[model samples]
Target: MEKYDNIDELTGLYNLNGILSHLQGHETRAAEGSIVIIYLNVMNFKSFNQRYGFVGGNEFLRGLAGEIKGLFPEELIARTAGDQFIILANSLDEKEITDRLTMLSEASARHDKGLRLHIKAGIYQQTGDETDPVIMVDRAKIACDDIIRVYDKSINFYDEALSKKNELRQYVIDNFESAFKNRYFKVYYQKEVRALTGKVCGYEALARWQDPVIGIISPLVFIEVLEDVHLIHKLDLCIIDMVCKDLRDDINSGYAVEPVSVNLSQLDFELCDIMAEIDKCRDRYDIPVELLHIEVTESALTTGADFLDQQIKKFRQAGYEIWMDDFGSGYSSLNNLKTFDIDVLKIDMDFLRTFDTNKKTPVILAMIVNMAKELGIHTLAEGVETKEQYEFLRRIGCEKLQGYLFGKPTPVDDFNRAVDCSFDVCEDFSLASYYDRIGEVNFLGNTPLRDKSFEIFNNLPLAIIELQDDIAQCIYANRAYLDYLSSLGFASLSEANSIYGTTNHPDIVEFTACLKRAQVSPDHRAYADIVTNGNTVNHKIRFLFDSGNRQAFAVVSRNTSIHEESDTAESLRVAMAHVFNQYFRVDFFDEDGTVDNIFLNADQKSVSDYTRDAKEAVRLYSEMYIYPEDKERFKKFYDITTVRDRIENTKSAYVVDYYRSATPGDNGRMQMYMILPFYYNGKWKFISLCRYADEIRDDDLK
Candidate 1:
């Protein structure tokens, strides 16, 4: 009856109290040779119980105890706790003990074929230095806990180094509350840059510890300690508050502010209402949701899927962007991408660190970027440290970049001062939106076309140019386009811009017509055959985007090799040119209302000698050519002061006005005049064209 109370009812082994009682009586025997205390712990035991039920778990533990007793027949053994056992062996030979333990593990696995058991042991050698059995057991358990996550090692030996480490961990745990209360932690910001422009687009907030006694502690150490104690959420929340306050200060000081992202540990969600806390901070500071981002690691997605899914949906519904950090660093990255609605994939830096040695790095990175783009998710490459890496990432179409090459993490105040001196800070939120759109385009590589079938568009043997605004400035051109420009006797895109410098250039006029045709076409596409430098080229123009005064188009061109024309074709072409000359004329003006150039196709000698001043020229042309009833309206159409603003307000590339032709004719006929305003060479310019109203499509002008 007395012995029954000391034994575990299920396993028939001595319990914790019984083991301690026996060890207390045999302390003197440890003086002969070192007594080894082996503390055995079964990892993931709760998972096993959940999988197989309490009955099955108890049966497995009983069988496991029998195996342990058989392996150490002469040694004292006791079941100290659930899934834990203590072995008191009178030997110092580690190899012999390890072999017996290995046999015990093998025998248990053989008994339970379905579940593989993982057992870890911590060995402590006692030379009679201390007599307290509880302390000895705790030290052994500490050593075991150190290797709980390390699957490769089955045992850990207690040593002085581990002792000191445990001491520091305890110190951090003891001082954490006071340290946080006194504001010993500081938040540092690392800038996220736009790959193409090298401009600061956002920041990632990182926490740093500023301990008074230890000076500075690495996050690796303190963060691990906090996570071990389940106190990491405090630090994370503290950092968030600091970042929000700093942003509020900057906004009040009239400094340009960008979006800031904060990292949330997995424990944060499990411990507290993280989203509500973040929202509280945001509302307190009055920060826009667009200026705050949330980041979660890929590993964090593996657990609490349903709960995290809800959290993610809540975050997105609240208008915050979610970024997956350390992408490709885990095994299930692709699956995570599909499972969650992530906005940005932060490619792990390890890929870039091993870029030179690992031949597959570049291939893997390209696939990730392309895959994310296809899924409508943006990509940001972290830990980029070299010019070569920057260029390669830019060429591969990475949307954002963050690394040491841009800048190291600094305090918010220091970062602000540095940005003021060296960085291009976006002053207006609208300008930030503009940069966001521009940054999406990769000038060094293939543009992400709207159609999936055109994935290989950039690889085709054709010249490609991305024209923007009404002036059709060559904002971006592929290598083929540059080569085509070289073939046309232009050394660079800048040189090629001379042809598009004036809106009245023949090519510009024709290009504008093609754009208008595209706007009216069902598919928003148009085709044209252009003759430049004695070469005929076929161009396929696709309209991409239009917002306010901004417009983008992709022009794909290929040479036709038809430099010479048949005699009949040449004659017809000349006859068409003669007819076009009789009907069309264009006038160009500078920002100051001065006429810069004129393209008068008709042989009109009377209107050839008008004054150079745009106002005077408009008055003379209106008086000489306009019908009496339309002169004031025609003059208003040429108002240089208001023309550009009107065109901009209209949000169209060109504006049109109707007037009657006053030139000598059999009868008065309605004529249309179009005005195009553009900025070039640091000045605003205007182009005006006159044509028969019947020849122009009314829908095309819209």
Candidate 2:
């Protein structure tokens, strides 16, 4: 059973500091001297999401999380965004694992149906040699990297290269949001050229962020984080928007602008309605869509080929070409040719690394180039830096080449000036004039609640949950639902396995199934305490269901014990007035209700004054501040919900006039923007309030 004292209500991620009484229990469990790290990531979460929607994507994740919990008890689990899920288990067997996995896999396949969940599981045994549990998990993760990317039987052990990448990736995650606004992130472009002529054709946009303190940011590091914060698509949009604006202006200034290709993240594919957004850009910039090109990772194409196909069709309709990027990066690259329509296939630079005139290069390169030609697809060689590499590619009949041979990525402004009227329109040209060496570069750069948290007791709705027997599955939760897990130890949720932390604290079995059932039902609301029992927690819980899979649960924890009701009339007025301003508009009136002041939910005092008008119209309209249709509704609501004295004011506005409103939603919900008619001086006038609910408890106000 999960029990804790404090439930943090801020961000959804769990914290350390959990069940203190079980501290010794954790030590003993660690002393069992056996630990297993299972780095299990959901394969193709981004693809699934792109095909479905975010809600469905999350439903898949939540459901999978539940199934995983059922498979392992006394294991720590934390969702590392996208499809990655980590598990740290204490004292388990090899045979038991296989049996458990087979059982779970069959069950999941049955339950998930069309929303298939093919998981990549990486395992490592902790021999107590590793000081940090995270390191043990890293070892397991190294084992799973290829499996995650491509399901294979050969599990790799941790190596220097993988570990280095892991450290870089983990660091980016730890500082994701903060890194975006930091100085590190910047653009890096690789040149794309016409192969036969060996001149620069275009540049494939890239990202490189270098930090003074943190070195470089790797794409592996920040990409997952970007997806979590919903910023990847925004970043892509920002880049595309900037490029379109800059490129259009340059083209008109007599610059021969070759189409540039931009790499799109999976997050971009999912969040953005690319077709509509692209059309908007085309119209806005009045530029031919063919002037732009987009490259999708071959892996990305392999998983969500249909979506890419539709996008490709859309772009072509809008007159743009599509390229399959990093063609040799994975085995799926070749398959993508069969599955997806493409205008170009950019050869990976790795092939060049093995190039020697007489060696393995000529036959393979010649064969690939011939294949592209036979298929009627253009072949572009990527990373042709040296004269020898460029010359060799040209002889092979490749149509395009991109590398340091022509010019590296330059600033948009620099490229515009550098490429202007400089080379033959038909010949492959170089941006060599603008290419310059940059210093060292650095790295480039989801879920809800669960059960096990409901064991603790709390007040109001937050405590309103009943576990599904000892399975500890949360069948319900109230408004403060999710906040009950914050500040709870994350060891359970994370790899620490402290027995008190959230990452692993309470394993809720089949959690996704319950949520799916609830989501489709009208009575989907429920409550549970998401913290431990040892401490005095004032948190609430919230339950949300994943719409797509409908099986996953997004348990949100909230702190709702701070509402303070004041006795003083002014204090009460501020509190009530704030609720109105925050959610709607509120007004106040005097005892006799004889021309008491009026409250207007806005500033710009130069406009009509509510106090003056409210008093004059009070007798005829007690519903003076409220809309006529809402007047009776508000009256009844006030009668039942309000506990204060004598029909206080009973007026409010976001009103431009007696019959009209200022802004559509200006009726109440904004403290400073609210207009409160008070009995000030001899007349009634609406006083603007810019107060919030929590600020009402402040003694400084009195």
Candidate 3:
């Protein structure tokens, strides 16, 4: 029974039971020699197992056991727990213990050349009155934790207070389920408000417990206890059920209740079919799925990408919106956004909390909000405790905000009152007051059509301006245009209105001349270099005279400041081929194998020849011009079907392929065709770069 129960089969080390038995036997027998039990722990053992395989981890443990046996003869050694070992060291002082630990560290370093193993030991001196071996071991483990944190220390003596703390923790774990069943565990809600309108949009459900023994216990304490006991999922499920019941009650009461977001732990999924449990709760209460939101922490997503993605898909499929909570609180914030299809990104409060201390915090917050907007995801700033933080978030266009300033987590009754009041107040504020404050719609005489038009274009990703050509004073500028000007250090449209032709600025003078010409011919298009905020940028301008309105409008299109050279080259080539149809024919091959050809009037016979029948030309190039040896490769590489499939599968904008093309020209020249394949308007098009045989490098294939 001792052998089966006490010995670890893999490493031949005595188990936790054996360690206890040895300590108890020594106490019963009154063994002499001042015995001290030292609990040893391998630091970051989980990381070790991840770096080396489980088999290797077991071997390493066995090897370390052997070395320990050699270091202390006739000592009782036991594997207490994961990466934890217990040793009964007799007749040894602190110095002797320290020396032994030093030797063990050196031996471990020598054993594994790639890895340096760190070991920490906690010592408990046994006295005659000490009866419970479990308590003694617990105290030693507590000391080991202290040593683990302080890297300079190799060994530490057990403290009485740590033992008491451990007893409290153990008590909480033992009574968790009973307390939860007795209604001590409860759900509290904190309202999430829209930053711009200050309207309560939803609530985040937070767990709280009023323990009988411990009185009101913070979730910060009980949550760790539950997690340690592998019972956090139980708490999460209970909270979800409570939220659903509350939502159903509110709906029955004829109150418009916002959706409540429930936090989930990574272990929740590992513990059970959480989705099934959530569905059961929803079905039982007959609650709409939209009323319950699922929030998973960003840190939880790091370990299991594929599994979490599947879980998220299931949640979304079941009509539940998923919010990535505590975003940027851990590593890979941007990566989490890319990997998960989250509906809302909740920025970590740490960003807002450090706003005053860190100069770059607000900039980072703004950038994150901008990035989320760019990805078509709404952003929620968490922990907005101050009016300054709220106003800053609002100015930066953060869609949602939640913090102490709005309200603390409260009971359902109080939360309902606050929600009702917020929505009522929001209703009193019209859309015009909230969104139409921009100059564009205000300058357009407030007509419904003009306001609707402004609304449509205001939120566009590009900067747009509706300019009156006569005065050239800025009449209307979209949100994008205002944001662009702000980024260039201009405060508003009025401050950045130097682009008007009325200004004596060189850029404006050139732009005015182009507008006048366009007004006369209706086809004159031009570009001007404008200096704003110490930086020069080229703006392409187009003018059109609306005959019915008797007003000429100038459209100023700003080019992106940061564009890749390859993109620029591609854009220029496409534009040149499009505008000068006489120089080179632009052929767009549809995914269905149909081709649209734009003819260029050029002296080259091949240009005219290909433009006459683009489809036949493409077929001949695939059949005849392709080198016989490279025919199969060329066919696969240049096939529009293959390009379309590649783009679809990879979600990539473009793909490039290079192959030998035997042009049907003088000398039957062997030229290299560098094909740039792109998908546009639901079709695939390849722009070929004609390289002469002399210019074809040997490394072109690579």
Candidate 4:
């Protein structure tokens, strides 16, 4: 009866009491040398049991115990607790112990029905100083718990460092209640600004621990400890309450108040009615529900996904906005976006951490923004600390922005003081309306002339200008439009604006008439021919928006000469070829290395015999016209197969190569060849251009 009572019924292994009794007889041997105590726990055992039945779980444990006994036949083993096992070894052979542990882990995995059974081991080497087996087991347990949340490590050794860490963790857990009641956790607000205009649109609330005895405790330290103890929900709720009170006070003080967002932990929903607590705080403070946004991390949705989905629905139905925080930080980010109806995606700052060094970061960021826009969800880029990052996000149509560039997280009072002093806070701004207007314009069109540089509109080929009010004040112009202004004898857009304000230029009058027509038109689009510097230019005007005192129109300009009734298709083709030849000598080729056509200015005489094969023709031309030093480069540039592969691999619209000409009247001037690939009808075609390098702006090449 005593033997049966000392053994575990499920695995027929020694129980805790049996192990302690055996250890008492080995104390004299332990005092002679060092002994090792290994504590092992099955990770996620509860979830495993939930998946497999209790009978199945018991069977798995029995199999694992059998494997452990087979591997450590000479050592004493015990089934101390549920999903936990203890081993007492007389010798401290680290390699031998690790080898057996590895075999046990592998055997358990091989028999894991369908779910992988992960086992974590903690080893404590005793120098014969302590006689208490319970204390040794406890120390081993501490080492195991230390790595409970770590994924890469499976085994840890007990040491004084781990002991100290456990002590600190216990201290935090013991004083959590006191910290909450005494208001040691303070709320900090980080401003979120409109990307288009640097105006404060909203703020995110963060919690900071101000310990009375230890000065300011970093959230990184306390937050992790609280999360491990499942007390993070308490701190999160306290933060929500503090944010609500602060907003109410701000309203009472007649300060401009924007929506403040609060973060919630996953445990909050499981431990308490988080939604109800939030609603209670809102009602208690008499604050509007719309003024409070809820942010949940993407990783939080991985566990209890269905419950979180329902909870998110409840919050949305209650008129609270839901933002998925730390997007792209987890593996299931896209799945979570599809499962939950998220309003905004707070992009992870890790993407921008290597923004300068990593080339893929900007491309990934742009794709995320575009994908969110297509799904009708907004985007907010966090950790924007530079002007370059700000401009990039703005150009990519990111709706909201946050980071140290605008301001760091601060206390409510300090934030208010900064706002009163110099912070640019937007009052009564409607972010929805702003994004709605921005969404109407398709900045990246599928047209052939559209530039691939999505980071800046200045690289676009068409002249884009923004006009305001009835008098047609030029408010903004892209680089193309600025160049167009310079063509009309104005050094800059400001010079042209000065002329429009002082005198009635015929072009201004015609543009103003076009703007009025666009405003009244059903589709808000109109076209007009404006005369400037003895040349007629066609302007297509579209009404953008009207803000009581001012109205804006987007004006796209093109030369009207080609649109004349007298110009036939053949004449237009010839005229266009001639215009293109003025800047670049052109060649058209098919994918099969066939030169279909060529266009050159009168000054550029053909120097090689015409050939049907495009690749051979390039080689022949390079020999005849390329400088001796640049012949190899010129030939390589025209390698049709290489160019085709490059375009396809990079998805680039065009590729450019630079070289010099060796022709008799040429002075070895730097020349650029640009190759553009296109799919026409049923086959691929390439358009190649030869131009003097100095004539083109660097921005145009982008």
True-vs-predicted CA distance for residue 278, candidate 4, Å = 1.3
**Cα-based TM-score, every candidate:** 0.57, 0.44, 0.52, 0.60
lDDT of 2 by residue, 152-217 (tens): 442344556666766776677666556566635666555666554444456676666566677766
lDDT per residue for candidate 1 within 1-702, as digits (tens), equals: 756766888888888776776667643333235678899998667767878889889988998999998898878788988899998777658898888888887888855647777899998877567767677888888888888755578889889988887887887888999899899999989988877677777889999888899778778678888988899988998998888898887677766677888998878888999999998988999988888899998878866778898899999999999999999874468888878999888999989998778889988898888877766678899999999899899888897899999889988667446455233554344466686565454433444434444244453334334445556677777776676667667788887786776648676677667766665555676666555676555466777777667666777665544223222233223333322333356556678657733333331222324467778877888886788989998888888888767877887787888888766651568887777766655777666667888777665454
Most accurate candidate by lDDT: 4
Using TM-score, give the best candidate's number. Answer: 4
Predicted candidate 3 versus true structure: per-residue lDDT over 1-702, tens digit per residue = 755897888778888877777766743433356878888998756767888888778878888888888887667788877688988867788888888877887787655536766889888876646667676676777778655535467778866665665666777788887987797878888878877678776789999887777778777667766777899999999999899998888667655567789999989999999999999999999987877889998878977889989999999988888999989874568888889999888998989889999999988987887566556567789999999999898877787789999878888756445446445733332342243133122221213224232133443223333445444555666775566667666687877665453466665555555445445442444333344444434454455545554445555433234222222334444533423212222344444555433221111223213443444556566664566777777666656656657766776655555555553342454554444575454645565444455655566534
The Cα RMSD of model 4 versus the native structure comes to 19.6
TM-score of 3: 0.52
Rank order (by lDDT, best first): 4, 1, 3, 2
RMSD of each: 20.1, 29.3, 24.0, 19.6
- Deviation in Å, model 1, residue 427 alpha carbon: 9.9
* Candidate 4 residue pairs that clash: none
Per-residue lDDT for 624 in model 1? Answer: 69
